[model samples]
Target: MTTVNADAATPTELNVLVRPLPDYPDAERAYSRSSSLLWRRSAGAVEILHPWTERTISDSVMVASLSELVELGVLSGQEQFEDAAVQMICSSAASEESAWRAYYLNSINELDNGTSPFSPVHRRARSLIAGHEVLEVGCCFGFFALACARDGHSVRACDISPGAIDLLTTASASLRIDVDACVGNALALPYPDDHVDTVTLIHLLEHLDVQDTTVAVTEALRVARHRVVIAVPFEEEPTEHFGHLLRLTEDDLRLWADRVDHAGAEIFTDHGGWLILTPHR
Candidate 1:
């Protein structure tokens, strides 16, 4: 939910420029002056270099999750962060889109790899898909949609975030993968009733309130001919960085199924909690 707004004082056409860190005038002083400077330590810690907001983030779960991408050179360096922030401030529409596209293109290489954290989750989700026509709701960057397409499923995906949809669209075209991705709300899905065989709300419900979650599940069930698949992270407390608002347990998922008009509900745990809701004919 990061919104980038361009300052009226800055030039719309201005592109971010990178210079050697050592050559910059009094690097320490410059870091103090600029609020956007981020420094990466050799020990693998990230330090936000704002004068009043200097803090070193520990090697927590979030850092560990992204470490593989960094090691694989899929993630950007410190300089890129500075540049990207400048781009976001100066010319957000084009630059933000470009940033997302670049990240998607780079990260997809390791996304489905055996060692990747995402690999097992996606593999399990892919196996649970019941039919040929699939729709993945809240498919950020459409990685699963791409995987489904590779499996010969007529895959489509949508997300609430415009930047995410744009990234997915750009990556699908670049990889020559056919996935119809668009920007749409989960509560009010854009597809018609029984439009696809399976509708998946992968890691999406945690971001929604209880009311919206019910509406989203209802919408998915309505749109899916066979079943609706839901996956959520099992957390004691929701992680704010990931924009998670609710910590969903196995019982929570079962309760959700009870509230819906599903023929049956099968709940389990793999990397996270998995709930398969079979729609009534």
Candidate 2:
């Protein structure tokens, strides 16, 4: 698979969320076993074609988590595949941080050496953090959680996808960053009530329904001693490619504030909708 720019200007450029396939023979062996799925580049987009089914795995495949991609036969599940991907990224980079930065820069066309798509939101989220102990709920790759750890916070991150958590744990260990990473759900987080100073759900609510979003916010509020921070993309329509089920707005965020008991609530926009709710003492 090839990593193409999501925002590539050309009409023919296939904009898809794909990682670079490992160059090693072991990875090649793993790819060969993937249900006869082949990446075919056409005029419009790169299609995952299954020879047996004679159909493309398109919108049906949720691109939300790494594991989902693996389940759709778009990625390999073998241990060697993971190791090879890690090795490929870490081969030439000076440090693990730089390696990840470079990977993001390539994966996301908008990202530069010093910035990512979430950098602005992360900066705001970091500033609003109540204390040093932080738990990032629904942390896909644990990038924000890792950022918090790097900034001197006791950070813990969790996601429902085991594959994503595994990748985060492996990368954290390789990066020499101490992050308590685990597999967890947003509606029912593994952490106890008031377990951390702050709980953040960055770019997570959009993927959930209204009811689940409420439950997740409640759960985050339950686990947070000081504050619960929620962020969602303010899109006109939900982006299906990224698995966003809901198009969130500031009013939707304020409704959470109305329903939950909080000492204070702040709703604003800095790249996207940000809601910071201080838990009632």
Candidate 3:
């Protein structure tokens, strides 16, 4: 597991401004180490490298397996509902007790689609999370939660859907990762004020009902002692292909950050946007 180096300071806010990279910062070096078997490169032209088989779960396999479960009617009527259907399929996948290939599909799809963790925004957000006690809301497969645990942060992941939490719980055990998972709602998180040092959400706000955005933000802010962090698609295209109710910009995120007078805000734009709310000392 990777932890924050002691020389790394605690971050009150993260403000990384980015644009799409033709390739990630160290692709060549990363691939060299991989092709040499420290990691393995995917066969595709994009050259997404895969780590040793036991090191991490690959994304494509996870996405395909998850899609199959959906087609098999695992999430049938719940289609239009919140991510409950998606959650159920993830849980089923994890419960299958198969190798990494069968279990981590949803994680792959979300990362590939840039809806959740593994985005450039998340890469930057790691600085803020390195040494904090974090509570993650709407933590789908708990990928960030897993990342936090790997980095030795104390993390608790909660979701409105028990199915998502269930999957996360299974993944944690099977993968031997440490994360506390449970059920909680975005609109009405079940935690007291300052329950943790920081509260974070990744790629979850856009799916929220427009009216509930304020409610969700308020609840998360209320529970965080230091700050709240969020990542959302920047000026996303108009599409219902996914349940995104509203695409967000820094200005929109500012509205949510402003609810608390003592909270100061910073915005980082990358593949999408990242919002950091730091408390005034």
Write model 2 residue lDDT over 1-281, tens digit each, in one string.
44434453332233332233332334443333233333433445433322211121111121223333344433443342244344445432546566554543343222222334455777788888988899999988777787788789999999998978986787678677789999999999998889999999999999888888889998998899999988888999775545679988889989988988788999998898989999876
Predicted structure 2: clash tally: 0
Backbone collision count in every prediction? 0, 0, 3
Residues 78-186, candidate 1, lDDT per residue (tens digit)?
Answer: 3433343333222312354454444444344445555456667788888899989999999966878887887899999999989778767887887788999999999
Deviating ranges (above 4 Å) for candidate 2: 1-113
RMSD of each: 10.0, 10.8, 15.4
By TM-score, how accurate is candidate 1? 0.69
User: What is the Cα root-mean-square deviation between model 3 and the actual structure?
Assistant: 15.4
lDDT of model 3, residue 155:
88
* Candidate 1 wrong stretches, greater than 4 Å: 1-102
Model 3 weakest 10-residue run by lDDT = 11-20
**CA lDDT of each prediction against the hidden true structure:** 0.66, 0.66, 0.59
lDDT tens per residue, model 3, 201-267: 8888988876788788778778888888888886546334345678778787778776655557787
Instruction: Give the clashing pairs for model 2.
Output: none
